[model samples]
Target: MGGMIIVEEGALRIVGGLVDGRPVAIVQEADDVLFRVSGNSIEDAVAVARARLGAGGGVPSQRAPVDVPVDAAAPTPSVPPRDLRALLRAAVAAFDPLRSEGVTEGPGKDRYRKIYVAGWPALVHYEFLPSHARRHMGVELHVETEKAAAVTGILPALCAVVRDAMPGQAVVHDPNWVGGCGRLQVVFPDTATADTLARAMQQLIVLTRPRVEAALH
Candidate 1:
């Protein structure tokens, strides 16, 4: 089976402070492996990791190539098939940077990943909005704390921060969100690739983690 490989900066053991290196994670049927790799960029790190695994920097196919005669009469489709699950997996792989910052990814439903933000595990919701004229696919990052005090104190501030940063998108606070705890949510159109989703999550982390830290102290 083709393994799930992840390349991220820094080690998992070291936290709270900054780590100054890159790490490659390879999870397969044989074994789960993680090791440091020397590189300036993720691409470089991936290459090194691929070498270690005896991979040629491409996804290994399960089946071997078979010779077949081409049918020239067959009509070629205009667009290729899109695999949402594969895209989600790619998105998770792109979120390697978040892992270093203690933003662990848990299981998610259908099209999104469950991302931990500011110590609160929230779902990265993928909604199908038929009402919208354009960009029907909506991606929302909803963060909430179970602590009652934080709902009144932190969520509003966090909502405001997201609203101010992304004025074009919808940002709201739902008091009934996630059972009873208040949730701060920021929504945007899902028009980009997996890398873009990872970047958006990282950007949100950068914007709100400081306030979260201050509230904790």
Candidate 2:
């Protein structure tokens, strides 16, 4: 009902309408009462209008549809979650010193098994803490130095630096100053994956070694 074209001697009007549920544009002309043109879609209407007006050089060329590969659209495989104990074992096995010389159990059951860091008085270790329901793991560096106060004093700054570079929280604990011992620990949840633990431990060692060495000096 909307498609209508009115022609006068010097003026013309074109009205738009729908054809088979798709919108169409009506084309008209001035100066001469010529034939009308209609298009099913806006693009078709625009093309018809341009062709009628002698614009856009000529009718627009049609482009061929592109074909996509099936393999390119396929979903990738996901990595399965690892068991806690197995993940911990994998993380411990990743350490170079532990792989070469093996680990030595500490004095008590809760304490970490020591892995010596070459050319330093400090030793690296890993321990698992089990509570009533939850469990936590820690990768720690214990330094044996006579100046316990000096080591503890530099720890805050060192912890700040290490925290910025690492994933887990960095903590310093000095329970027995008489023995000239203190520990710098990176704590992570037991639910963490082997890869995550391994990467965190590696980052902890890299960030902590130079700081502990400087503290000892």
Give me the displacement of residue 22 in model 1, in angstroms: 46
- Per-model TM-score versus the true fold: 0.45, 0.44
Task: Report the error of model 2 at residue 47, Å.
Answer: 66
| lDDT, candidate 1, at 188 | 33
Clashes of each: 0, 0
- Give lDDT per model, in order: 0.43, 0.44
lDDT of 2 by residue, 1-217 (tens): 2222111122332323233334444443421124445676444554565566554474332321121122111111222322445545566656544332223333333333455545444333333322212244566655555544566566556655764665223233433433645555565544455565556666666676666556556
Error of 2 at 14 (Å): 71
Candidate 2 colliding pairs, count? 0
Best by lDDT: 2
Q: Which segments of candidate 1 are over 4 A away from where they belong?
A: 1-84, 98-100, 109-111, 117-145
